[model samples]
Target: MSLKQESPDESLKSQIYTFCRQIANSRPIISVCLCDGSMRAFFGGTKALLEFLLIIKGFKPRLMNYVRFFDDRPAIFYAVDRWVFEKDVDVGFLGEAFAVHLIFPYTPLVNAGYLRAKEVKLKKRLILELLENLVLTFPELSREIRIKPEYFVYESMLNRARLFPPMYNTLSHFFQNEVCEQNFNRVMEGYLIALKELEKEGLVECENGFYKISKSFIENFKSRKTLFTNLFRSAQKALFMSLLGAFPKVLGVLSERADILLKFQFFEKG
Candidate 1:
């Protein structure tokens, strides 16, 4: 199948679905060659690759029903029916089945680009704060985990935006000081000190200079749904207040336009 098919009005979702369908029809374990111009043309650039992943994540429930993504590096590998496959199978028929199943009957109200931006800025910040709070509040877990400051930033970048993983240089460049000098190391040192406390609790582990959050740790936290819900609500309220306080113009505009407030209420209710 030629990958050069063009659709001027094609949305990102359609592009991703097409790419995945092509891979599913190929070998059981297909490697998408990003170095080739075809994949780049489909995705636009390396940054758009990240955007593609984020967009796919938004459709996780639907996609997970048929196929599952293994990893993004080297190339994206997926299995048709199983999460892991030992050998290749004839999946040409399955690809057609997926094409029929994955059809979008109507155009999406929000495009992938806007969704990605919103998620990176708001959803990612909330998640990072929650993770930090989790580590700090649980002393036992803290003692077990040892994480570098960079991990939080990298994880946040991955979670919020599709930006590449934070490397030494990227971190340094992004977090420059007032004098235009990088002080990421110093900031990272502070994070490491906090993470070290968690490391003592035997909950955290460092593998090849990267701190890893264990599955059990996440499960444990997830089990405490009530606590997390309360914490999340409090955080949301605090964030809203902070934003309002920071932008007096926004507050003034909202006050002057009561209809806008009512519209927001209607949106929240819906």
Candidate 2:
């Protein structure tokens, strides 16, 4: 029997998937390594690794410096402790290591360069706001609001760039942020998870295969004097910087509004 050659992204995904499955099976795995040039980091614990993989799956990291898997062993720990504390606790056989090396095509739409913990949370909050506004503004059909998950993800990343160009640009690290057909399923699934989160927050309701804004959410939104209160609270600096940078005219307008500065606590000493 022979195995077929897999692309760099696929190879990386397979290795991580195997490592995750091993962890699930109670293997003695310590961590998964993500390497880029001279920089590298370990993603430990099941939940964190899974989330990391989710980002990789959607982004399709183009130039993988290579992924290395390491398993736990008493000998490695003993050597480390002896070097640091001048004492040893245990010594056993060495652990196993697996490495996958590959280089992907140039000009990949998404890559590991954009994958950051802070950016992930930022993107999530922005997407939630986008969906909320969509449901609220889009005309209802037959007196029932319905939003397709697939369409939302598609438009949010590409078609709707004009509506939130700064946000989409910031969410994407590269110059190109278009969604490829291959990665759309995972991306859509990721957004579906976001939709579920909105539903859990009582902001949206799901019924008959679509989503609509919850009545309470509508009432609250109507009562509010500003629409971005929650959005600003969740992402204060990033959103402000992006918006201000995109539109310098906004700065001139904002500078004249002393009340706005005080309201946002920009005048308060930190």
Candidate 3:
């Protein structure tokens, strides 16, 4: 059945099964010993990692939680067992195998900012960066069209803005290193000011908290394709740099599983 015809639970199950089957078919397996506790930990860690990855890909937190509980755990275990039985590898090795084969490769596309993640911090810099990237990637955003700040903010938050203080709180919690209440307010203020500055520069028109891009900017941007290309390249550079900073921490986490460490080394070489 098509995804639209299925219940959310069924759809989730299908997605998990598909992912497992792909892994089962593709990755070469290796043997490794694991105690029951270690196996459980690997599964738990993999689940958490997937949840984080999904969150970064703009999935709703509530939906991810539901899928994790009802579908992901079972599917993951099934994949591990299938790999173990088929390849004569210990079950422990499959977690790292799945992560290296599936998760790492998928991350870059998600990090590309094509779909804004839910719970993504709507800091002024990120919003501006996104706008800059959007203008670079899609000429349409540069056109003269009215857009409400509220609408922009809502979309920037990936439609999760409706959760209000709670949503803000969640973001604060997750991004504790980068965001706090004071910083959040400051960033918001700066975002508003940036809009005002764009209005002042005649790049946009702001009236009564609503704004519209200027026709002149659109015409200018159209002529300056090279500038847009540079902006796009810069956005990509920034994304990779951001990921690099977090890579060590992620590597440390995966290193706990020797099989994952070896798989990661193999993937890195290729």
Q: Name the best candidate (by lDDT).
A: 3
| TM per prediction | 0.28, 0.36, 0.33
For candidate 2, lDDT tens digit of each residue in 173-249? Answer: 22233433333443444456666777888877888778776777666655655456534432543443344233322
Candidate scoring better on TM-score of 1 and 3: 3
The TM-score of candidate 3 is 0.33
What total of clashing residue pairs does each candidate reach? 15, 0, 0
lDDT of 3 by residue, 65-96 (tens): 11122222321121233222222112112212
Worst 10 residues of 1 by lDDT: 99-108
lDDT scores of the candidates, listed in order: 0.34, 0.34, 0.35
- Which regions in candidate 1 have their CA more than 4 angstroms from the true location? 1-148, 154-181, 226-231, 234-270
